[model samples]
Target: MTFTRQGCLLVIAVALASPVLAEGPDPVRGAELFPIRCVECHVITDGAEKKIGPSLKGLIGRTSGTLEGYDYSDAMKTAGIVWSEQTLKTYLVAPRKMVPGTKMNFNGLKRPGEVEDVVAYLLEAGT
Candidate 1:
C-alpha cells in the first residue's frame, strides 16, 4: 500500500500511543506474582510485624529502612531512599545492587515485566 510520510508518522504515533501497545503494570497480575516472588520474606498486612523481612503494609512513600520494629541493614538505612513506583521498579530489578549491603537475600526479579507487576501489587496491596 502507498502511504505519505506524514501518514506513516501518524500511524507510528498511534501505534505507540495505543493502550494495547503500551500496557501498563497490571495489579492483578502483580497480586498473583507477589505470592510467588515476594511472600516468603515480606508481608503486606497492617502491623509492625517481622517476617523474614519487614512488613510492607505501608510501602509506598515510606523511606527505606525507616519502618519501625524491623531492623534494617546499615546500608539500607543509610541509602535514604523514599519508596515510590519509579524507585521500586529500579530497586526491584537488583536489590543488592541498589543498596549494596541490604539483608534481602533474593537475587532480585529478573523476568520480563515481573518487577513492574510486583511493584504494582505492592503499591496496591501495601498501601
Candidate 2:
C-alpha cells in the first residue's frame, strides 16, 4: 500500500477514536447486572443501613471496611484496602480469594467482564 504521511496519520487517528477498538467498562450493563447479582446483599444508595452487606455508596476512594454502622468481618476490617477500579476488579473476581475470611457468602462474579461492569456501575452509582 502506497500511503501519504497525512493518510497514515488520519488512519491512526480514526483507529484511536473507534469505540470498538477502544472499548471500556460498561456501566449500563453493570446497572443491569447489579440488581441481579448484588442488590440482594448490597445497596449503592446514600445510607448506613445494613442489608446482607454494607451500603456501597462512595466506594471508589473509601477504604475497605470503613463504612460506619456496618459490622465487617475481621479480615475485611484489617485488610486495609483502598477501593479503586483496579482494586475492585481484583476483589470482585473472588472476594474470599482476595480477602480471606470475609463474611460475604457469594462466590464471585466469575467473569472478568462482569467484574469490570460492576466496578463501573459502583463507581458511577456510588458517587
Candidate 3:
C-alpha cells in the first residue's frame, strides 16, 4: 500500500514516540499529568497553606499524616507511612487501598507509566 504525506507523517510521529514509550514515563509527561490529575485538589508550591489538600512541596520525605496543619483522616493519621519513591509509586497506583479512609477522593492512577511519571514529577516538584 502507498502512504500519503499525512500517513507518512503519522508513522514518523509514532516512530519517534516509541523510545519514550519503552523508556517509561517521562518527567515532562509527569509534569503534564500532575495538573490534569492532581492539581484540582493539591498544590505543589512551597510553604503554601493547604488548599483542598496540603501543599506537596517536600512531599518525598514527608510522613503521610504529618503535614502540620492539614487535617488528616483518622486512618491516615494513624497509618504512619514515610513517603519514599517506592512507597509513592505503590500508593499512587491505589490510594484507598494504601491508605483507606484518607480524605482525598482520587481513584488512583491506572497505568504503571502514569504512576512512575507522577512519582518522578513529584520527586522534583516536592523538593
Candidate 4:
C-alpha cells in the first residue's frame, strides 16, 4: 500500500493518452477504412484525378468543383459547396439529400459515427 514513481508515470501516461486514443476516428484509421468503404467511387487525392465520382483531394476548406478537369454535378457546383468539417459532416450523413442531383450514387452512410470517421479520414488524407 504505497506509491511508486513507475506506477505514477504509467498512470499519468495512460490518463494522458486515453483522451487521444478515445473512440473518435483517427485519420489513419479512416485511410485504412476508405478503400473498402469509399474508394469504389471517389478518388481522394491532390493530383488531377477522376473516378466514378470526383477526386476528394484538398477537400477540407476547398470549394466544390474548384478542382479543374472534373465533371461535377450541376447541383454540386452551383450549390456553392465548401468542404469543411461541418459541411462534410452534414453531407456525409446524407449525400443525395444534401446535394440534390449530385451524381454520387451511394446511399447515405448508415452510421453517423462511420460518417464522422470517414470525414475525418478524407479531411486529413485528402490534403
Evaluate model 2: give its lDDT: 0.88
Q: How far is 73's C-alpha from truth in model 3 (Å)?
A: 0.6
Q: Write the per-residue lDDT of candidate 3 for residues 23-70, one digit (tens) a residue.
A: 786788999999999999899987757778888988988988888888
Q: Write the per-residue lDDT of candidate 2 for residues 3-117, one digit (tens) a residue.
A: 9999999988977776543466888989999999999999888877769999988888999999999999999999999999889988888999999999999898885468878
Q: How well is each residue in 1-127 modelled by candidate 1, as lDDT tens digits?
A: 9999999999889777665335767888899988888888988889887798999998999999999998889999999999999999989999999999899998888876688778878888877
TM-score, candidate 3, is 0.81
Ranking by lDDT: 2, 1, 3, 4
Predicted candidate 4 versus true structure: per-residue lDDT over 33-65, tens digit per residue: 789878998887668878887788788878876
Worst 10 residues of 2 by lDDT: 15-24
RMSD of 2: 5.9
lDDT of 4: 0.78
Cα error, residue 32 of model 2, in Å, equals: 0.2
Top model by lDDT, which number?
2
What C-alpha lDDT does candidate 3 achieve relative to the native structure?
A: 0.86
Give candidate 3 regions above 4 Å deviation.
Answer: 1-21
The lDDT of each candidate is: 0.87, 0.88, 0.86, 0.78
- Model 4, stretches more than 4 Å misplaced? 1-22
- What TM-score would every model get versus the actual structure? 0.81, 0.80, 0.81, 0.76
Report per-prediction Cα RMSD to one decimal: 4.8, 5.9, 6.9, 7.6
After superposing candidate 2, which stretches have Cα over 4 Å from the reference? Answer: 1-23
